[model samples]
Target: MRFARHRTDQGPRLAVLDDEDALIDLDTEPDLPALLAHDGRLRSAGEVALRTRRRVTPWAGADLMAPLDPPTVRDFSTFPEHTAGVVKMLDPDAEIPAEFWEIPAFYFSNPYATVGPHDDVEIPPGCALFDFELEVAAVVGAAGRDLGVEDAADHLAGFVVLNDFSARDVQFHEMRMRLGPAKGKDTATALGAVFVTADELADRRSGPSYDLAMEVRVNGELIGQDRLDNMAWSFAALATYASRGTWIRPGDLLGSGTCQGGCLAELWGRHGRDHLPPLRPGDVVTTSVELLGGTRNRVVPGPPRHEILPWRRP
Candidate 1:
């Protein structure tokens, strides 16, 4: 089932997309995770909406919020092509990290700063090379630990389109410190308005991957595209690794890192920095994963560079 959250005069409302593409207001909880905690309650709510046909809102005019505000976000770099592409751009002489092949690596990111479909993302101050990483994120529905791939799949509640926005300049500098992506990534991360249940995507499963077409468009121009099938490490495997030694609770978000050619970082690394310009104020970005949904966001100017100046020793 396709689920969503929309803003209303009252507050954020949980909703389910009907067969007719209308949003049936579940109105039980404010977000997806809360509803997910109720077991089969979400599906039952969908059934009631279809039968009653009352309070059904048209999908066109609804204000979509991020499908889920996960408690935590674990973003994994599982696409070799993206890493390889990045290496080609950053330093052709450098080889892809052997650790990436040896183990699944991920970083914890801010969950509080998530934006929804049609939301406006403010470019972080001092960021001139703004970029977007197109990805698919799995929403954990149940708690588990030390799970196998198949068991991890069972723990997944659903999937959503994710856009990991980045400030390339900040990211590059911070990584040199060998610690964070903190300021570079914490600023903004966008998710699609709709969340598709795992069962809904069962038919699309191939091995441990989904046969989905993922793409991103900037100002109506298609800039990047890739197939989920291309992921070297499956989502299940990543989740399994993340769940090790700790409990993965409901509402945790696990992301498949940037797809091949999914961001300007790799693109500029490949072609030439002069070839593609960074995202700027008023630019629109649309990222989508087939069957999940799409998120369209407009870029807005941030604070003056000086206003957000980072700390430095005197």
Candidate 2:
């Protein structure tokens, strides 16, 4: 089932995307997190809709929000080709860390900063080089701790296309300080307006990865494309690794990271810095995944640089 969180006169409500592209009110639950928590009952409303076709709203008219605003967003680096491509552009001789292959590494993101499909993303402050990471994200279905790879798949609710908007300048600078990407990332993350339930993807499931085609286009021009199966580590591995003595809560988000050739940073490194211009105000970025759906976002320039950080001031 394709589920989404949409804006109604009352407020954000859970809804199901029907075959006609209409949104049927899933009045069964208050919100997505609550609905997912009650597993068995989650699909009750969809079944009712199929039988009764009630409370249907046109998808074009309904205001959609991020399908699920996760409690905690955990993004991982699982694509070796993406990493290698990035290194080839920035540091040719750099080797993939042995520890990277030993375990799936990830970083937490600001969940509150999520933007819905077709929304405008404000470029991060002090950033001139902006980029996007085309990937897929799994929304955790239930709370779990110390999970094993084999047990992780059962904990997923569904998948959505994820855009990890990036500020390359700020990111590279901060990473040099020995900390992970922060300010460069905390600004924005775009998630699909529609969330595809896990059961919907059963046919494409192969071990831990899905045989899905992922693509990113800028202003209607295709720029990045890759197969989801190219990942060196799987989402199951990422989930299990993340649950090592840590709680993987319902509504938690885990990203597949950038697919190979998924972002400009990798493209710039692989081709040339001038191969494609950095995202500018008025530019539109759209991405789609085979079963997960997609999102379209326009860039809106932020305010000019200011002295919020006195150390950088003259």
Candidate 1, after superposition: displacement of residue 30 in Å? 1.9
Residue-wise C-alpha lDDT for candidate 2, range 1-314, written one tens digit per residue = 99888888888877888888888887665467777887766788777766776677898898888987788899999888788778766686766778778878888888988999889999988999999999899888888899998899889888888999999999888999889788888888999988888889889976558899999999999998999988888888888988999898888899999998899998888788999999999999999999788999999988777766556755
How well does candidate 2 match the true structure, expressed as C-alpha RMSD?
2.0
Model 1 lDDT, full chain set: 0.87
Worst ten in a row by lDDT for model 2: 305-314
Q: Which runs of model 2 end up more than 4 angstroms from their true locations?
A: 309-314
TM-score, predicted candidate 2 vs. hidden true structure: 0.95
- Give the per-residue lDDT of model 1 (tens digit) for 73-126: 999998888998787766867678999987789999999879988889999989
Listed in order, each prediction's TM-score against the native is 0.95, 0.95
Model 1 pairs whose backbones collide: 89-269
